[model samples]
Target: MESTTWEESVTDSINTIYLLFSAYLVFVMQLGFAMLCAGSVRAKNAMNIMLSNVVDAVVGSISYYLFGFAFAFGVGDNSNPFIGSRFFALADVPNSTYDYTFFLYQWAFAIAVAGITSGSIAERTQFSAYLIFSFFLTGFVYPVVAHWVWSSAGWLSPSSSDLLFGSGAIDFAGSGVVHLVGGIAGLWGSLIEGPRVGRFDAFGKPVPMRGHNATLVVLGTFLLWFGWFGFNPGSFDKILVSYPDAADQGNWTGVGRTAVTTTLAGSAAGIVTLFGRRLLVGHWDALDVCNGVLGGFVAITSGCSVVEPWAAIVCGFVAAWVLIGLNILALKLNFDDPLEATQLHGGCGAWGLIFTGLFAKEEFVIQAYDSGETGVTRPYGLFMGGGWGLVGAQVTEVLVIVGWVSVTMGPLFYALHKLGILRIPVEDEIAGLDVSSHGGYAYVAHRDEGHPRYYADYMRLQDQS
Candidate 1:
């Protein structure tokens, strides 16, 4: 074999560094998920929720390593539009120079997507069953969606002849593939597990089950927002080291635009959610603010590189409304989503894809795809003189993804339910998952003092003693 050139070697090293750093940032999202879920539940189940968050990373990694990467990004003629058939145990993956870093980066994404389902099914789910679900989710369900949109041989890819229309499905950082897929899975899991014991009264009225800690929820939201800088801008990985043509000139434009769009959208959505709640409910709700920030983050993720700043703001604004509307609709429909995962991830995720079709710019889409003018089929936005073709494609993509996830994950949960392991016994649930599942309370103070103490109260007690 011929020796590699020094220039090629140096570029590969830089790309590897870039991806590793981005993967680290994405890995921090695991802590965000832990804090968010732990704080969202009652104190009695906090440990269980936190454990599930950590387990998502642990089990998701192994499962994805076993087969997820293969299904997601595998190559070769055997790799079809629907699924990849190679690298089941990551066999021969080390042969390629770029494979390792890419695998780690995508592994982070798989774990993050798999973690989304944990919150909606929290409080009453069996710990063993959750581990199983997370494994399959990373290994198969999530990878299939990633393959469908992001893989070269994917039928939904703009480059694929099998594509329905337009530029095929643009999901910059997986608003649909990651967020929507997990959202629908969470919805199915929640429906299968049924509501918590007291989620709804006999009259069918929803009861308020407030989270025990608002501080952790807000902190988790901030962390997730911070991590998104990597999520959106790092997706510009392709162009960062591979500006091969004049059309690829100034590729950093897409990266910088992505960062700006992400920030503006999150900020706009947060403002809308915070103030909107005050206007509608007579006071600001911190929980709503946290969810709103996340909803904004999810909404702009798909179009951050393709849309203008103003369009990103619109996406955030619309995303916050979608979140609020879905929260109400879920409650009215008797759905029990503890962290509002369905609304924050599912509803906003679909909106993100739709908004991309409405606002994506032709030049940026060209820049983002890195194939110059020929890379994408229907590159312009509906409002950007591109007409309705892209919009039609986006809507179809959303429906197809939603249908696929629902059909696949719904039955997975149903099978688990039939095995009598999906949900824990009522007595164990009423008693609290921390004690029942883990054999201890999250806070020893609560066990010792017989009542939970606020931080201020704890300080006061220390002073008195």
Candidate 2:
């Protein structure tokens, strides 16, 4: 008995360390978000956007600690399908079922949701509005969605006693829960704010308002890619649990496979986008490829653990077209999102959930959902002959996420707009937020003796010399 206790203690320690490392990796994605948002906007708005990203982390930490974690994972004697009511302010934490490490891991995810939304309204939103929405989103709107899908008492949870359609939605790593929630929220915010000034010409023609630096965009993309290894594989939450039928294999095997699928999906999408954009626009563009890579990652995140590697490649292939097609539609509709947050995270994220419904393997599903322990096999991928139950659940998840975020975030943005605090003024936007609102340009070369046109004057003088 003593030897058994010792073994269990070692396993617990190892799992704790694993979760903490994964949380750290996920935290690094915040830096990636900062760089990506900074690079994707004009240099004038770089400081503003980067500052919002910073605020997302800081505000998200406090809010999630005080309420978001409880709303997302807190359980009580009278557990409900929607929203948690315990552990507020980290009260009664470190219990048997949940620990500090778990809270830290979840907090990382909560911040990521806010980061994704910040990209949609970049360049034109008021900083005060950013703070209000970030706090509300990370603390309330997002946590409700997390509860519905991740909490054991959630109606949509696979672990729920009464599963939706006998197989709850398989958002293995939050394609719907995180990416879709963020994306849909962004969609509402962008739709209400309209396009950024100068994004569309007088006659409704599209204008290419490119970012100032491509190097930063590339750097940010790579950092996000590196962080995704933690985002997907780390969702497993443990690497020590062994499967009953498999000899010398466990969740560790699933973790490795998830990482591989993530890599292949992103890589395939990047390659496809590189060539697809060349054909569409007669030029190779790295920015398009980077967005495509992220889109693929977003799509495959739902099924990274349950789908085969080849299926992941297919997911990426279709995901590239989905992003390309969405971009074209966004341009036609005159809907301007600076980071393509809605299309990449919203559209591709929806596709990822469907892909899971179509391609998830039965055995992998059993392993991922812990159905083997219950001895009750759940429905899986439609194409794999597991039937329509799982696919129906996936479709339901998409529809509900769209409905939920739209209902919640849509009105908040509209109210802010009505109150005249959502978007910046025309003069401020035209002069660039950095000069009019943020006090200075992100690049020092643009700042010359407190004059706005200093860089241009300096250039002309150098030419004369």
Candidate 1 structure quality by residue, lDDT tens digits, 1-465: 999899878877877787777788888888888888888988878989998988899999999989998888787765778887554846626466577778888899999987899998999999988888999999998888888888878877654666556567788898999999999999999999999987898999987788878999988988888788878888866544444456345556567878999999998999999998899889989889889989999999988998899999999999999999999899899999999998899999999999999998987877677445444445568988887767877787799889988888899999999999899898677667887778788987554221233445533543454
Model 2 stretches with alpha carbons more than 4 Å out: 1-4, 86-89, 96-98, 371-375, 448-465
Model 1 regions lying over 4 Å from their true place: 1-3, 86-89, 159-163, 242-248, 371-377, 448-465
> What is the Cα-based TM-score of model 1?
0.92
Can you give the TM-score per candidate against the true fold?
0.92, 0.94
Residue 98 Cα positional deviation in candidate 1, in Å, after optimal superposition: 2.2
Candidate closest to the true structure, highest lDDT: 2
Task: Give per-model CA RMSD.
Answer: 4.3, 3.1
Residue-by-residue lDDT tens digits, candidate 2, 122-202: 989999999999999999889888888998888888778899999999998899999999999999999999999779889
